[model samples]
Target: MSNLEIITESRFTTVFIIKMLYAFMCGAHLDSIINEIRELEKPSKNYKRMKPATKFIKQPLEGLWHKHYEQVGLKSMAMNIKQQMGLNNKQQKIFNNTFFKEFCDIFNNSEIPQDKRIEALGYLCSGKQYIDRINDGKLTGEWIIYHHCNGKNYYLNVGNHSDGDDALAQEIREIALFEFPFFKGSLPIFD
Candidate 1:
């Protein structure tokens, strides 16, 4: 088997892993969870103001998405985004970098099922539905998710808040989830 293939090891190595697995399966990645925790860590950031949500922008995002994807590490973009929101803070920026680094670790681990990875990638699309926060000045985070396109190189946001991303991952997952249910494999769209 290729080194990238998903191995058949038991995923329930720990309760936290189990919970994480279930949560990811249900449309939330560690990034989102981390971001949520970060929000809680700073109540002044309107701790309870945010809510999870899903949205669609039928218009293609090719322009700005690609621009941000190419310019610099997401950390810069994340900082720029936060700065624009007047919520720029040092601690949270650090969390974003760590979250992205961990995301890579999870992406590379063979023990993680490809379907699950696809599910994570699926965040780019939303069968399970990419869970995103509603009120946390995270509108800019959507762009950060582009770092995960089909195993392409991913760059972490350097500064530090834990919003590995917001809209970007959800938009991708939404697309993936939306497309997943209709696939017939080789069965043909109609026999």
Candidate 2:
């Protein structure tokens, strides 16, 4: 097997290894999750928000869909798409750098089935359809039920939004607040 395949197969083990390395670098014990948390909490000016366009673009259906794929943890599936479509290195890098790590993290946390995860990722990566689904109010509530191109329903929930900066923006932001944790603590202003 290729190195990448081996690495992918041993994700849990790799996570453990990464934790061990982190602990060793910081002179800490392996059994202490709190220690890791404490170390992470130390203020660092290097932190920066992921750019929305770089992370979640507003145009080109493919770009948007890819972001959704990353959000839901389906890089392998996304990679398959890249291979099948003969994506160039630049495109591959975009998916690899931006969403691959995030996908791994989400996969580790979520208990959703693989097929369902793939379906959701597909919806997310399909930019035009994803926007349509969101704008059509199909992505609201505690769970999102997306109707795929083939007419099958796939269920998942990013969260709900209740307010925004304006009537419409506030409503959109409210939904975002619930569905996306990054927006949870943010203030919603209507003008």
Candidate 3:
């Protein structure tokens, strides 16, 4: 059978789909997806030792562990798919660009709902909270971003540096790039 068929096949495909969905929802790339799946798989062993209330509880936990491992397996499978389909260069670029552009646009437009805009902006500003909020569609609005003409100007006029500095800002930008590298040309680059 074809690779696409394998990705669509229910049993194997669900894991692949979940991994991709997780990656997309978390604003991560394939590498991050691989890392997350690896992390998920590692947690399964710890879960194995835990005593469940009953067989029903244990079975679900076991099923969850299996699913986690399956996602890890799918990460390898995804690599194969990336190579086989030439997704590494062409398709990857297209997907990244489209995803980021859409994500950023959703944030910039006030016409978008306040909660969603806050959530998108939160993702741009804070990675940890972003991931948590992604699936739930909740907005924390705790992080902030500022623009400045110069170092002194940024420090003095923008806001408190204690909240986050240029270095942190740079990190956020880097993470954004990781999620959507192809979007370099499309996004407004601030100095």
- Per-candidate TM-scores read 0.22, 0.18, 0.21
Question: How do all the candidates rank in terms of TM-score, highest first?
Answer: 1, 3, 2
**lDDT of each prediction vs. the true structure?**
0.34, 0.31, 0.35
Q: Report the number of backbone clashes for model 1.
A: 28
RMSD of 2: 21.4
Kindly report which residue stretches of model 2 are placed more than 4 angstroms away from their true locations once superposed.
1-87, 111-116, 124-191
List the candidate 3 regions with Cα displacement exceeding 4 Å.
1-87, 120-191
- Higher TM-score: candidate 2 or 3? 3
Least lDDT summed over 10 consecutive residues: which range in candidate 2?
Answer: 60-69
Against the true structure, whose lDDT is highest? 3
Error of 1 at 26 (Å): 31
**1 or 3: which has the higher TM-score?**
1
- Writing each residue's lDDT as its tens digit, candidate 1 over 33-69 gives 3443333223354443233222223333221121111
Candidate 2 lDDT, 1-191, residue by residue in tens: 64322422321223334433443464433323222122223423442211111111231111111101111224423443344334478866875665666556546556888887776666545543344333432221111111112222111112112321133232233343343344333222211
lDDT for 190 in candidate 2 is: 10
Q: Residue 60's C-alpha lDDT in candidate 3?
A: 13
Best-to-worst ranking by lDDT: 3, 1, 2
